[model samples]
Target: MVGPIGNKFAPIGDPGRQAYEDSLQVFEEVIQAACQQVGIEPVRADQIAVAGEITDQVFRHLIEDDVVIADVSGGNPNVMYELGLRHTTGKLTIQIGEFGQLPFDVNTIRTIQFSRSPRGLIDARNQLERALQVGLLEGPDLLAVTRIFREAQEGAADIELSTPDVTVETSDDDAPGLLDTMDDVERRLAAMADNADEIAAAIEIIGAVTESAGSEVQKAAQSGASNSVRLSLVAKYASDIREPVEKLESQSSEFAEHMESINDGVLALLKMIQSSSPEDRPEGWEAFLDQLISMAESSREGMEGLNTFGSAAEGLGSLSRQLRGPGRKINAAVNNMRKAIATIDSWDRAARSIRKPSEV
Candidate 1:
């Protein structure tokens, strides 16, 4: 199955020793049973080619395998790209995903749903076994869901597949045409639009909260509240802001991971495009690379801002711990308030740095 395999994708618990164990269990049990139902031995991308580079092996499997089962949990980019490659071949492909983690691009496609629980796992295995049997005998109905596969099957009969690179060569009479390219571009644009909307909405909400907190602070100061009371109010505001900052930081990290994957994809595309004739290359390819570079730089800047805020918060915490005595408790509280404001401000700056792609 095409999915993440490392510890980083592992579910949390068991002091981290059981990293990826649950995922492995699900895959080994369900996929093996599915293969048995189809009366075939299961062969994964990793197992087929033991000596070559991992990606090359994966590409070979994507093209040569009679049927592919993709586990698309976490929306892992490598898996998605491989799934795309498999779809382009017009081969039998089945997609499975955790209940809620499937990406938007693949959400409309029919996928066998799985979960982490024991009952869910049992159901998933049974469902996959049936799906596999049907797919092996009659092929799957996923063609309509993936425009790429449908276009390839209709417009490009007999796709060429080679080792180390799964390239599609078409004849003059029945070239896959621009529809497939346009569809890919549309999906990329949609994914970006969704991410931008989410980031914009999150930043707007955070900004509104910060503004309200500032107003309250100002009002409290003018009302002659005691320093202790004002400190307490600020502390509460700081605590509230921390949750969103943490969330934004998590989003930023995920964004960085996704962009790294995009960078790899862009590099691969550039190599492939350069290998082809100038006429075959997509228009404005360099411009596309430039846009990616600009976004990468902005992402780097945002990550740096998060690191800075983290350092500052750690320093403030250290300072607060160093302070002793009842008199210094208010001082510690003030420092915490300052640290929270700094963190919120840092997040706002980070948000600004991660501006819309159109802005770049």
Candidate 2:
């Protein structure tokens, strides 16, 4: 049961079939098996029986079909057009895409993303089958409605996850594709590490500038320099630290934003884990936990790094307070840490609940 990977043929006057041929072939094999597991016939829209049926026949299926499994590789214009028509219906639509090619329209929607490797093909099939099982249960459509924007003026999409024990809120343009989401987690972790280190270095530069001006400040105070002259001295010192302070604030803001997204992905993942039963874990339970634990640890480290920054920034109390925007970010980072720690604690308890089969 495999159908519509787009009417992708070389002479067909459509360039939508841009997936690596090898991976496409793998998808065909595994998709059929997945369909068979759930007693559904898979059909690819490779052709239209009637001339105008491209609109009439296809439109009927898009609207009337129980579910539509769209492989949106290459963001094929044809597939996208059909997918858009289906979106208006808000029916059961499962979108699958190649890594790094996720589109903005479905950015916030849950998508199955895979690389073009052998294992990746198998993983995509597994995810598809699970999605089918969930959809057939009369659950919400994968593309149920236009995603809600948490910050309307900012136009950012949000994923808010909460359980009795913990709550995590984060915003995304779309999500990091689950498979790609992990890769994104890794990238952001590295970037956060870099940003934190750079901030520490920038702070050192500020400290040096302050110490260098100490003697001059003392001399002016002793000599009873006039108010204007003393103010000029302060201005010169402020100038010396302005560039580094500004840099610190910019990096701090980015750090806060990135940290939120990281926790967002982590919490999104944890919810998925809690939803699945022990008998049917999402992906391989072991591998999933491995990545989850790694991200959690990295986030803790990031939190500590921010704590260190907060302590260091406190030394610049009066000066930084006068520079309002620069100091605002540190507070956000500290607050984000508190939220993330709650998320991690919840995750830790969940992980410990999963015992190995041998141990069980």
Candidate 3:
């Protein structure tokens, strides 16, 4: 089920209202596409048979719908209230809104961001579809999990504060010197490898927390909550994802550069092979083939890493659509990385074909 359809959510004006109408129309498109992507029957309150009052219909849908899509744009109170009702049931729900339109309270949630422009609408639809597929498969109750964890942490902190003189012991072996710290880079990398399986899990948790905050923001906005209150709610959520997005942007850019360097080297070797006679072929061509094989393997690994970080960055970006933020940079970085990977793979294949027994 989806909500805040028609003019009830729009502002009272001419061009401004028209823009909202157009954006909402596009959002509906996103919702329909999301249903198709996840292979679910699309049901919304507006679509239901008018067997009774509209309120009753909305009430039933809020509690019973398999999935609920809420548009929190313009701080629409009705949609926010309906979304809150859906949450109480703990059923699957997804939130979406325009860039810079969602309330700061709900801004922490990973909303599928859209623009009023033609291009923006198309991008929003595609993103909403992907998000639905993921949400359905993962069954993330990010809001619920975050709330439980937050309450638990608060309770634990209270208990610790009340209990004085609580201490733990550490061994001399646990201490690391400057040399050990300097040499820990490889160990850190190894630990990252070991922790690879946890990336998706961590992303899920972060997304849930963000989404939870978004819902709260929506609710508070509807209640005419102050800016300070909303800002406070999002502070922790923003900090949680912001640093990761920045780090990802840096790493992905560096990775793309590496791939470009490798790409240039491979093209040079390929040109050399194409122009050379068999007798005049580079002496170390055989060893170069081995290195190419290694680079191909690394490229594949880089692609996987890019994909993982890209997904997280995309969610974070959706959370905050500032021009310099991860939401924008993540997409560019991911696209560049993908192009690089494809080029590298093609070059790998070409190099291997040249090294074939028939070619020799």
Winning model by TM-score: 3
In order, what lDDT does every prediction score?
0.55, 0.60, 0.58
Q: Hey, what RMSD does candidate 3 come out at?
A: 24.3
lDDT of 3 by residue, 1-360 (tens): 554555444567755567556545754677676668668866666667777898888888788777778777776677777876676666677777777787644433446666777787777777777767766776754453344346665674332122324333348887643334323422432333333323334445545665786798899899998978776666655666666545555555555555554443455455555456669875666655555555555645544445544545555543433423645565555555455555555556666766776642
- TM-score, one value per model: 0.40, 0.38, 0.41
Question: What's the C-alpha lDDT at position 284 in model 2?
Answer: 57
lDDT winner: 2
Checking candidate 3 for backbone clashes, the offending pairs are 105-217, 106-214, 109-210, 142-208, 317-327
Which residue pairs show backbone clashes in model 2?
1-42, 2-42, 3-43, 3-44, 4-43, 4-44, 4-45, 107-174
Candidate 1 C-alpha lDDT tens digits along 41-126: 77765456588688887788888888788888777788898888887777788788777777755643456667788787777777
Candidate 2, residues 64-173: lDDT per residue as tens digits?
A: 88788777765667678888777766567877777777664543345666777779778777767776876788664322232222143357644433352444444975
Cα-lDDT of candidate 2: 0.60
* C-alpha lDDT (0 to 100) for residue 326 of candidate 1: 18
- A best-first ranking of the candidates according to their lDDT comes to 2, 3, 1
Error of 2 at 233 (Å): 64
Report the error of model 1 at residue 45, Å: 3.1
